[model samples]
Target: MILHRVAKENYNLLYSIGLTGYGVGMVLVPLFAEFLRQAYGWRGGLLIISALMANIIPVGMAIKFESHKNSRQRNGFQSVPSSPQGCNEGTESNSSTSQDTKGDSSDEIGVVRTIANSLRQSDFYMDPVFNVVFGVTFAYNMVWSGWHSFLVPHALQRGISVRNTIIITFAAAIGNTFSRVAAGFLTNSLVKPVTLFLFATILNIAAILCDVYFDNYYAMLVTTCISAMSIGGRSVLNQLVVRDRASPEKFDVAYAVDQLSVGFGLFLGGYLCGMIADHFSSYDATFKLLACIDVIVLLLIVLVRYRPKSNPA
Candidate 1:
């Protein structure tokens, strides 16, 4: 019961954070980008980003402090139901075996055991589909981050106009924003989590090919829309999978693990695409490589199942 309450509380907090952060950030970036360009020329980009970084550092510190507090709570004294709660002292005595007595310190012990307990039973491990959904979400995030960080610069190096690049970017962001809002609504209504994942996989693959096949203004806009839409849809889908599949007690752990994939994806995408785009004179080659990756990841998503374990809810 405590776990269930904690899970619900966490879900509400995280959902609000995601919505507000993405919504406000997206809305502000175009304006900020324009302001920087006007004020500092090309260097405005650097200045604006630096200012944002300045803002982030303090907020990040606060978050780190809170995270430290939570970690301490998780690692320190453990709680159990009292006798009046129907968990008798004798029951605890019976369960506390030699192994429990052998534990070096209550605070230091149970770390491994706790993790094992969380995932030990059929209630803990995710369904096969959940695995695939997580993988696909991770791969797509890498691709999306790669596109945002490197693709436009590559386009400019290949002689694409600055105005067109901005337009493409704006269009993509607009598509993504609408899709994200729509996805939130739909997840509560029409779409099942797994079905949304499948759709996201298809559209994301299509987005990659858009860069490969089309290089002009109109194609850029369309391809950007595809890319943005897929990512937007997948954002909600990924969360839904965790919510549906994970037991309430383990939801936080599961979601945290899933988000680690996003971090790795961002790192890999930046490094890999940066290396490839730099190595090749043409951005076309980079797009082609990413396209291949997209295909492989899409197939993987399709093959993976989405059902949760068949034990207690």
Candidate 2:
């Protein structure tokens, strides 16, 4: 919903901030958890974290919607008239015309009814761009979730100390934070989001290979950092792809559908990767599999017919 309201130019930046917040949480939570647990015990520490989570309510409340009229005027865009009850007149007109032509009396109801009907239309699912976006999004989420879920365990299995693993993870979190913001800036100033996304995918493959073969602490640290950056960039890049392909009116629904893909990927990726690791008796095979999945994601991204609204700098 927030993405629908913002100008496309700012989408990458705002989304990057959101991703950065996640990275910050990843870094800070572990750092604070032990201290909090030592001071207040596990239950009390968890209670404190829960209390902190409530802060999001106030933050959400702070996001006020801009009036459509004001937004249109500010953007120097023409205002489409609204019906007396605040429904978009153009939408109503189209809906009415379609209803009359098709003799669909069910759609002649209220504004909400018409909107709901439009939302349920199969056109979105049939869109090639949407399908490609969904595929890449799903693949990216799968690899990301699987890696995060198992990276630490893999490190320990390979004879890395818990202390070094924690340090590597913290470094990765920092890289994640910076990379998300850098992706936004680069997208805005240096490259198309799709190009950046492709670059990230290639970088991730390298990182995965390093993780599979390297045993040195420094090498693992480098791999974690590179992997974090590449993975972090994907989050923003995927949203930009969705924004570029979706019609303005359908952006919210398209994004929601994309999120569903992410959820599916997260669940399946983690489970499948774990299963593969168990069967192979090594995380190396899991990393290689993830790299293969990234190749699929890269191909899907290439198939997207992206048309950016602005010229790339």
How accurate locally, in lDDT, is each candidate?
0.67, 0.83
- Misplaced by over 4 Å in model 2 are 6-9, 66-127, 305-313
- Per-residue alpha-carbon lDDT of model 1 for 138-204, expressed as tens digits? 7767776777776577668757789987777777667777776666666665666667777776777
Lowest summed lDDT window (length 10), candidate 1:
1-10
Each candidate: RMSD: 7.7, 7.1
Candidate 1: clashing pairs of residues: 129-305, 129-306
Which structure among the candidates has the greatest TM-score? 2
Error of 1 at 271 (Å): 1.1
Which candidate number maximizes lDDT? 2
* TM-score, every prediction: 0.68, 0.79
